[model samples]
Target chain A: MSTAEPPAVAPGATVAELGEEALIALITPMLPHAPGELVGSGDDCAVLALPDGCAALSTDVLVEGRHFRAHWSTGHDVGRRAAAQNLADAAAMGALPTALVVGLVMPPTTTVDWVRDFAAGLAAGCRECGAGVVGGDLSAGESLMVAVTVVGDLQGRAPVLRSGARPGDAVVHVGTLGRSAAGWALLEAGLAPRAETIARAAACLDAFRAPRPPLHAGPALAAAGASSMMDVSDSLLRDAGRIARASSVVLDLGEPEAVLGADVELLEEVAAVLPGTRPRELARWWVLTGGEDHGLLATVPQASLGSLPDGARVIGRVREASAQGPGVLVGGRSAGADLGWDHFG
Target chain B: MSTAEPPAVAPGATVAELGEEALIALITPMLPHAPGELVGSGDDCAVLALPDGCAALSTDVLVEGRHFRAHWSTGHDVGRRAAAQNLADAAAMGALPTALVVGLVMPPTTTVDWVRDFAAGLAAGCRECGAGVVGGDLSAGESLMVAVTVVGDLQGRAPVLRSGARPGDAVVHVGTLGRSAAGWALLEAGLAPRAETIARAAACLDAFRAPRPPLHAGPALAAAGASSMMDVSDSLLRDAGRIARASSVVLDLGEPEAVLGADVELLEEVAAVLPGTRPRELARWWVLTGGEDHGLLATVPQASLGSLPDGARVIGRVREASAQGPGVLVGGRSAGADLGWDHFG
Candidate 1:
C-alpha cells in the first residue's frame, strides 16, 4: 500500500456546500479513460463496443453502517470494496470486466476530499481487475451508499454457471480462504500488540477491506474445462451448498485440517495476537463460515484436474446425492447453524 | 392504469420478518424476462447476447426524501419514475432499451407488499419501453433508495451526442414539457379542493407521480437525422443551454406562445384548479424552466424538419453565437434567474 496520506478537506465543507455540478466536475477527472468505448461518462449514456457480442451484467449495493462503518473504513476502502464485490461477480461469470457504472448516495455532510478519494479508489479497483469506471450517478441521501453495476465481455466463451457440477468432479479454489474472516475477527478484538502480529493483522485487515479476487483464474478455469464455478462471497460451506443444490449433487469438503492447511497457519498467527482464543477452533470456524473473501471456486473433471491453473487447490469432490439431500458436508457431516451471511437475518 | 388495488401486508409485517431470501423469491416473479438473454437474475451475472455488438449504459440514483416522499408517492410510482429516468437516458442516446439492473436499499421496516409493488412498477416501465429487468441487488439501509442501471442496444447506428448540434438547426421536443413541474407545485401547495378542481389536481398529481417519456421518439428522431439530442430532466432553458454550450451555438427559444402551445394549455388547466395563481404567468414560468418531465429534446437539420415524428413539436431554433456567450436565450434575452433545477442549490 502507498504510504501517502489522504488529502485534507476544509473544515465543515460538505457535498451540499460544494453543489452537485461542482462535485461532478471535481470527481470527473479521477476516472480512468476507457479505450475502445464510443462514449465514456459526461453524456446521457456511455456507449461501448462489445467485440464478443455478449455482455455480462452484475450489480451490488453497499450501505453505510451495514456493509462498512465509516469509523472503521476510509472513503477509499469503501469504494474499493464496492468495486471489488461487483467486479468479482463479473469475473466469476468467466468474463473480462470492461466497465462499471457507479451510483453514489451520500449524506450532505460528506466531505469533498472523501468523495474524491472514493473516486480514486474506484479507479484503482477497476485498474486492479483490468476494467474502467465509465459512468456514474451521484445523489444526496440520509446515509452513504454505493451501487455498482459492472459490464463484462465473454470473448465468445460460454459462461460458467453454478449449475454445471456433476458427480466425480473435483472442487477447487483459487484464492485465500478465511483470511477476511480472520481479519474481521482481529479488527473486532481490537488487537495490535506485537510488531510481527500487527503486520499479520494488517494483512488480514487489508484483505477484509479490499478483496483481491483471482480474476484471471475464472477464465483459466473455464478454459480448463471446469464443470461449474462461482465466486465465494459467502462462507465456503454455504456457497458450496448452493452449487450442490443447483447441480443436484453433494459437495464433500473433507476435513478442515486437510483442506485449509495454509489458511490454518494464518489464523494461528492471528489467534496468537489475541489472548483467549483457540487457534484450531477459530481456523475451522473461519474456513467453514467466513464470508466476503471473493475467491473463485470451481469444479473440474478428475481427468482435467491436471490442467488446473497455478494457485488452484483441490479441497473437495462432487458426489451423487444420498438421503440427506444435496448440500455441503465437512468430514462427512452436515454443516448446521453456520450457513454464512444473510442480509435480512 | 389498472384499477386493481395494490396488495396489502399484515399491519406489523416487515422486510425483516420476511427475510432476504423470502423477499427475493417473492419479487423475482415480478420481473419481466428478456427473451434473448442467456442468463438472467438468480445468477452471479446476467449474460445477454447483443446482436448489435454495442451497448449504451446509463445509471441514476434516487434517494427517498431527496427524490420522492413515501407520503406523497406510492411505492409503484417511485419505481416507475426511477425506471423512466434511466430508460430516457438510453433513448436520448438513440439506443433501443434492452435491459435494466436495479439496486434497491430499503429500511428493514419496509413491507413486502411495497417491495412487490415496486417490482411490478419496474416491470411495467420496462414493458412500456420494450426492455426487461435482467438482474438486481437488494440490501437493507436507513432509508429507501433505488439505483437503476439500464443497458441499450445501438442497432449499429451512431450514438446521438449533445455536441452534434449546429447553428440554424430546428430545436424540437416530444412528450410533456412542464406538466411534472406544475404537478409538483400542486403537491407542494397541499391543495385538495372541491369536485371540478379536485379532478384537475388529480391529473397534475398523477403527472408528478408517474412520468411517461416518449421512448419511441428517440430512435425516430435519430432516424430523421437529428443533429443533437438529450433528455430534459432539468429545466428546458438549463438543459438547452447544455446543448448550446456543448455544440458551441446559441439556442433561441422564442415567446412561450410559439414554443409551448400545448404545454401552455395544460399548465393553464392546472393553474385554473388553484385559487390565487395567474394562469398565463405560471404557464410561462413552468414552460420555460420546469423539470423532471423526462422529455426528449433534440435539434434537427432544417431540411429534415418535415420528417419530425408524431407527438414531436417544434420548440425553438439553434443560432450562431454572437457577443453574448453560447447558451440559451428566451424572448431575445438571456434567461436570468430561472436557470432550472439544481439538486444541491
Candidate 2:
C-alpha cells in the first residue's frame, strides 16, 4: 500500500487559480443535456420529472486512496467507476437510471485537467447507462472523494427486493465474477510494471480500474419475474448471504466446477500469470469472492430459469433454512469465512 | 486553525473494533421512518413515492478542517449542518423536503460512538425538516466528509427558479443574516474558551454550528406567487448576484438600516464582545457577506410583498439591467469585492 503523493500540478494551473465558478463553467458544457429534466445544474436544485410518480434512489462514495489509487487509474476511470456503482444499485432495484447528483471533494492544489477528466468520465458513464449527470457540488478537501447519488424511474414495475426469494428458487447471476479481484491482484503483484503481464491481463486491469456491470440485465430479470435481486458489490458469497438472511431461506451455491464453468478457463489464465500461487486455487477464490464487478444476482422460479436474460448463469438454488441458520452454503458446506470488503475492517 | 487531532477514542472502541454491520445496527433504529416512503434504508436503493411525479434534487459536501473543526463541533452538529444545507437547497426550489441520502467518509480510527452521534444528528435534522433518512453509503477516507443529497416533492407547484425574477419585483428574505458569520468570528476570536463571550454569543455560535433555515417559508412564498427564489447559503450579495444575472435584472439592495432593522442591536451586541472590531462595521460585513445561514431569499411583485410569509423582510428590488451589467448593487453601488467564502480561495 503505497502512500505516495499525487503528481504536482503544472505551474499556476491549480483549482484555486481557476476558482469555483470558473471550474463549474468548464464542466457545465461537458454535461449531457438530460431530456425532460425541468431543471439542470447551476441552480439551487435540479427538478426532475418521474412520470411513474416513483423514484429509486441510491448513493455511493469513492475515496481516493481507499477506493482507487491515483497511480492505478485515470480520472476518467474513477468517474466512470463511481457512476457505475450507483447506477448498478438502481439497476438492482429493477429501475432505469435517469439522473445523477455528484458531490466532489478535492484539494485546492488539484489540477483543472484532472477535474475536467473526472467530469467527462462521469458523463461518459451516465451516457453508457442511458442516464444523465444532472447536478453536483464541489468542495476543497485534503483528498479527493466522489459521492454520487443516482435516481432511477421504476416505470410502473414493482422493485425487486432482496427479501422476496422463496425456497426452491434458482439463484442466477449475470456478468463477470472475480475478474476485478484477479485484476487487483495482478496490479498489486507488479503486473503494471511488466509490459507482458499488462498486455496479457489488459481486460483484468481495465476491470479493476472501471467495471462494466450488466445493468440492463436487472430490469430484464425483473420483467422475467425475478423473485429477489441485488447487485454483487461485496462478493458472491457475502452478497448471497444477504439474500438468504433477508428471504429467510438457505442459498446452496453449486460446486465450483458447475458455477464457474466456461469462465474457469479465463480465470485460470489470469491466475497462471501471477507468481507463487496455484492457478486453480486462486481462480476459484477469485470467482467466488471477487467483488467490484457490480454484476446482477437474482433469484427466480425454476420454471423461469430457461427464459433468463442473455449470459445469465444458474449457479445456485434456494432451500429451506436449516438449524445452522440462514446463509450461503457452497457445495453443501459452509463458506467458513467472509471474504468480502468490509469498510471498517 | 489549530489542526488538533480529534479527541482520542476510548480504548478498543474504534469503528474497526465494532465492524460495519454492528455500527449499522447501532444506527438503523435511530432513523426516522418517513411517512409514505415506499422504501426506506437497509435496501440496495430506497424507493420513494412522489405523488406529483416531480422531485427536486440537491447535494452538498462538508469536509473536515475545511468545513468544520472536530475540536469545535460535535459529530451531531456536523451532521445537522450537512443535512441543513442540502434541505435548504430543496426549500430554495419551492419544494417540501421528503428524504435525505448521506455519504459519510471517515478514517478507520474513528470511534463507533462518534459515528452513532453523527447518524443521530442526521436523523434529527431530517425530522426537523419534515424529511427522513432514506439511505446512505459509508466509506473509509483520510478525513471526515459528509455528503448529503436531499430529495423534495413539489406538491404540484411549479418550482420558483432564480431566472424568473421580473423588473419591479421586491426581493425578500426569511431568516437571520450574518449570525453564523458573527458566531464563526466569535469562535475564531477565542470566544469559545471564554465563558462570558460564549454566554453572550450563544445564538451566534449555535447558528454557525447548525442553521435552522425557514424551510416552510419556501413553499409558502411560492404559493404567494414568488417570481424567483434561492437559499442564501453564500453571502447575500453573492447569492443575490446569482438571481440578478440569471434573471437578467439588477438587484438593488436597500439601505442597511432598513434591511437590518431590530437585528442591528443584536449584531452590535455580538460585535461589542469581539476586541479590536468596530460594532457597526463588523455587523454590516456580517450582514452583507456572511455565508452559511441557509436563509430563504425570494423575489415577488411589490403588490404581493405585504402578503409575504411571516418573518419575511423586504431587502431589495429588481430593476432592468443597466449597461454596467446585471448584478447585485448594495446602497446604490456594487459590492466592490467578493467577501464570501470561496472553496478554492
Candidate 3:
C-alpha cells in the first residue's frame, strides 16, 4: 500500500513500476496449463475444446474490505476463494470445471510477488476441480478485486436445476457447514492476529480464508439422481429458501437440532475461544446462517436416497408448499427472513 | 454519488436501500433471453448449448474513474463498452459470441435505475453479437467496476491465432479506427459539457462510449482463410506489433497515409473544435495509437484477398523478421516502443 519508490527493483517491483504486460508475464508462467486448450493466454481470446457440446458458466466477484482484508488473507487465499466459489457454482450445476477467465483490478502499490502467488493459488484451486486458468484481464483500481468466471462441461448429462426439487425429495448436503462463518467471526474478534499462536483457531481461520468445498460431490450427486442443487454460498437458510421458492415447495429442515448438531459440534472449540460466546448457540447460528463454505445443498428423490454419494447427509426433506407460500422451515417453524449476508444491506 | 435520503423509495431506490437480491430482481427482467440457453439467471450457473464443441473465451474489466467517469458516461454507456470489448475479443478469435457472465461491483449509493439501464445496454450489446447476458455476480465496492466474460462458438473451424501470420500475407482491417481515441480526447477536453451544441463531436464521443465492432466479419474472415487475426483494442501499431511478435514476422504498413487518410479525415472536424490541437496530426496519432476501437486486424493470404469480406481494408503486409527482431513498421520505419496506453504506466 506504500507509494514509496515502488519498494523493489526489476521483476520484484510493484505493479505500477512493472506495468500491466510485465506483471502478466510474471504471473502467466505460474498458472497450470489447461489440458486441451486450443489457445492459451496472450491473445484476444483463449480457445478451449468443449467436447460435451454444452457448458455451465458462473461468475463470482471478491472485493477488498468487503470480501477480505489483505492483512487477514493473503493473495493466495483470495485467489483460492475466488476460484473455489465459481468452481463450486459449476459443480452445483452438475458439471466438470474446465477453464476460467479472471478479471483482476488492483492498486498500483500491489506487489508482483503477490500477483504471482495469487496466480499460483488460482492454478492450485483449479487443479483440484480439473480446471485451468485460460485467460484474464488486469486493470488498476483503488482496491484489489478479483472477478472469476468459470466454464464447465456437463458431460452429456442434464443439468440439475434449482427448480426441479419434488415434494417428496430428500434434502441432502455435502461438505462443511458454518465453519467459514465461524472463521470469519473469529477473525473479526481479533483471532487473526493471534492465529499462529492459537492452534484451535487454525481450522476456522483457514476455512474463512481459503474454503475447501466438496466440488466432486456436485457431479456425483447429479449422477446419483439429485433433482435440484445449489452451492450454499449465502447461508443454508437463505439458499434453502432460494431452492424452495424456485421449486415451489417447502424445504423442511426437520429436527434442526439433530441435523445441524454435527456441524455445531465441529465448531464448538473454535467458538469457545471467543469471550462471552455460547459455543453451542454460536456454532448453531453459524451453521444455519453463515455462508461461504461452498457446501452442496441438494434435493434427491426419496427412492434414490439410498444411492446418494458418500459423505452426503440427509438433513431435510422437500414438502408441498402451503398457502403461506414456498419457504424454508426449521423445526416446523419459519426460518425468518434475510438471514444471509447482503453486500449493500 | 450522493448520500441523500433513500432517493425515491422502493423500486426507484438506491442499491443500499434495496439490497442485493431486490436490486437483482429489478435488473434481471431487462436482459434479453439467450436463444437455446438451457438455464438462465436465478441459478448457480447458466447452462448454454455449445453445439460446435469449441468455445472461445475472453474477459475485460472497466473500472470507474480509470475507464470512465460517471459524469461523462451513463451507466448504459459503460455497460455497452464493457460488453463490446469482450464480445470483440471473441470476434477477434473468429467465433460467434453466444453468452456472457458479468461480475459487477458498485458503490452502495448507486441508483437502481442506473443498474437497470446498465442491464439494458448489456442486453443491447449482446444482442448485436447474437449473445445474451446469461449469468453474473454483483458485489459492493467503493467504485463501479464491470468485469465481463464472453463465450463464443467456433463453428467447427480452426481458430485464427496471432501466431499464424506468415510472410507475404496481406494485413487487413475492418471497422473504424482512431475514432474512439478522438472521442476520448474530445470528452477529456471538456467536450461533454457542450457535446449537444457541437454536432461534430457526437460521432467521436459515441464511438468512444460504445464501439460498434464489425463482429460479423470475424467468422467471415476466418472462412475466407485469414491466417492470423486480432482485435485492435490497443491502437493499431501496438496490436499489429503483438501479431508480429507472436508470428515472428514484421507487419509493414507500406503506405501509411493511404491506409489511414480516411480515418484522419473522419476525425478532422472533431479535432478542429479542440483548442491548440493539430487536427490532422492528432487524428493521425489517434489512428496510430488510440485504443478501444475494437477494430479487427487480420492477415490473409494474398491469394484470398479477392475473397475477403466487404469493408475489409488492405492496410499492410506481413514480412519475414530479420535479425532486428519482430515488430511493426509504418512506412518502412519502426514503430516506437510502447506507443499505446498502459494502465499502470
DockQ of each: 0.81, 0.84, 0.84
- lDDT per residue for candidate 2 within A20-80, as digits (tens), equals 8777877877777554589998789899999888999989999988888888888899988
The residue-level lDDT of candidate 2 at B132 comes to: 88
Question: What lDDT tens digits, residue by residue, belong to model 2 across residues B1-345?
Answer: 001123444655988776666666667677786545897777789999998999999889999898788888888989889888888998889999999888889988898788878888888788876798888888888899999999999999999999999999998999989988988887788776662345547888888888888988988998899999999988898889888878889999986656878776687788988888899988988999999999998999988877799999999889999998888888988874356878999
Screening candidate 2 with a backbone cut-off below 3 angstroms (N, C-alpha, C), the clashing residue pairs are none
Docking quality tier of model 1: high
Clashing pairs for predicted structure model 3, backbone only: none
List ranges where model 1 is wrong by over 4 Å.
A1-12, A192-197, A272-275, B1-12, B192-199, B272-276, B336-338
Stretches of candidate 3 off by over 4 Å are: A1-12, A195-200, B1-12
Report the lDDT tens digits of candidate 3 across residue range B22-101: 76776776677665688888888898887777888888899998988888888898889988998999888899888888
* Candidate 1 lDDT score at position B282: 88
By lDDT, the candidates rank as 3, 2, 1
Segments of candidate 2 deviating more than 4 angstroms: A1-12, A195-200, B1-12, B195-200
The candidate, 1 or 2, that scores higher on TM-score is: 2
Clashing pairs in 1: none
